[model samples]
Target: MALLETLSVLSGVGGLSFGAYQYYRAKSDEKRKQELNDLADELNDLRRDIDGIVETFQSPTTKVDLSHQLDYCTKDVLAYKHETGDNALVKAEKSNGGEKVSNAGQALDLYKNGDTYPRYHLTLESGYTGYESNLVYAVSDHAVYINHLYKTLDKLQERHKGTLEEFSPGLYDGIEGLMDDFVEDTYTNILSHRDGIKVNPDSHNNIEEMGRFLFFYFWHYEGITKELESLSQLSDKIEEARTTILQASY
Candidate 1:
């Protein structure tokens, strides 16, 4: 009778121990899920940043850069003392000709050999020493980066409809983007995107798989976030340069 009673008590103790273990595991799993959820939250933040940059940067950058290019000439102009001597000669009434100069080609009155002696061969103040201080080149690079980023990320968002990431191409997709993103044609120092090509893009393969989306979500997402952040910073810098150009133009 004593052994039987002891066995019953032991049984109850064992069941409580198991219950505690199960509760601990449940709490651990919940913590892990929240951690994984943070990854998604970070990616969403990057997407919003990318979209905001694309919206604000694209059209205005083009207009500002284009206007700067066409309106500001670096050629030798008859830099005579006008009423107000400013660097940029955009939209002015020429002293040589009473006609108003509305564009950049008209800004710098080209030096004629017989006419002016102290002709100034002006370099655009925007560039560092010999370069122009415009947003054209930097904006070009930014365009490529951000454009691909937008399309790729947008597609990723569409494909990542939650179910283990099956819909989109694998991140290691193909050569189509490789050429424009870069091509190692010169073989100079062997700088190449050799590794990225090895990854999945929904493109490079034919076999339909279920895990490619999640693979990128888990692995490539952080790198992508970094890229978007860099682009955002670049966009702001470009905008500042654009503002400088505008101020100089006037």
Candidate 2:
């Protein structure tokens, strides 16, 4: 009878122990689940913060609009110069019996032969030397402005090279080509004219060289105009790229 009673008590103790163990296990599992949930919430919050930061920098509208002011300044310079140069030429030609000299040599010959120098020649020389300061000032201002534009395009290419090419393959190529042409040929010719025989138009060989230089100058001028036009297209493509990237989920 004593053994039977002892066995019953032991059975009851074992059941209580099992029940306590099960309760502890349930509590542990619940705690672990809550921890996992908190970590997931934190991760989601971090992702949202990162997305906001990325949106701020990669916003195409903000970045592209930064260039508008500089672009306008460049446009103004080119337009002013083109207008002044053309008007000066026309006026001078009209004054000289409506016979516009086709080349620099012809103009130089007329100037050298004791003919009152055409107003255009004087105006162009002065204009080339900056309506404000000296020749160096004019060239420097123009070159610096152009270089700013070129550098901006270069950085845009570098930052979005893959995307830009995928979207507009020849865009950067055109910019680079025009820049190369200006640096190698157009800029060199202008510098040569400025430094050499610019003051002395009496030399026939020099005048001929000037004629050739002017031809190339006009060509480069046309190229620059086209380059400026391409900016609008580039702006559009950039906006498209931004929209595409924004819409895609990471």
Candidate 3:
């Protein structure tokens, strides 16, 4: 009987020990699960903060505006009237003709006589030896400018002749003689000056002076932007005419 009672006591003790061990294991598992959840929440908060910073930096808040201006010249007409009376041809009491007739003619005359250039010859007589070098340079420069101007004129004449051949043959024929005369005069002047330079190399101080004169002459003549403007206008007109002809053909 005593043996049976001891055995029952030992079994109860073993059961109590197993129940305590199970409770301790359950508490440890719960603590680990709580730590994992905390880590996951912190990671989500960090990602949200990074996203907000990115959005703030990527926003556009500035704007810009730009503009430009251009200028040009055009002819102006003051008055125009038509008369149906007996004296239909009422001329002006006093008129200076046109700008081209007056100014262009004067310019042509000056150009022909070399008056458009500086009067270095007169300046040379002032006994100013210091300016002799400058005078030589000036003369050389003027000669070069005239030569380039003649070449440019020749080109313009050729273009004018080609255009006349296409559209205004009669006008071309009438102007041909005048153009020939102008060209001949220009050539004669150039050859005479070139020959003069060869004979009077002493008149030029040095090779440097000759070079300076040639450069300045070409620079001035080549600086003529008016021809470029005229060429651009001609190109535009030609394109317009071509387009019109193509459209008509179609």
Quick one: best lDDT, which candidate?
2
Winner of 1 and 3 under lDDT? 1
CA lDDT of each candidate?
A: 0.32, 0.38, 0.31
Which pairs of residues clash in candidate 2, taking residues 3 or more apart in a chain or in different chains?
none
Off by over 4 Å in 2: 1-139, 195-250
RMSD of each: 23.4, 20.7, 35.5
Once fitted onto the true fold, the runs of candidate 3 whose alpha carbons sit more than 4 angstroms away are 60-250
User: TM-score rank, highest first?
Assistant: 1, 2, 3
Q: How would you encode candidate 1's per-residue C-alpha lDDT over 149-249 as one tens digit per residue?
A: 44444443454334212212332122123222221121111112112211122232421121222122212322344444555554454344334433332
TM-score of 2: 0.29
Per-residue lDDT of 37-107 in model 3, one digit per residue for the tens? 43333323323332322222122111011000000000000011111111111111111221111222332
C-alpha lDDT (0 to 100) for residue 173 of candidate 1: 29
- Candidate 3, 237: how far from true, in Å? 69
lDDT of 2 by residue, 39-133 (tens): 33332332333233223222312323323322332333344456564312200111223224445444333333422322211113345335672
Per-residue lDDT, model 1, residue 214, is 16
Residue 181 error, candidate 1, Å: 2.8
Candidate 2 vs candidate 3, TM-score winner: 2
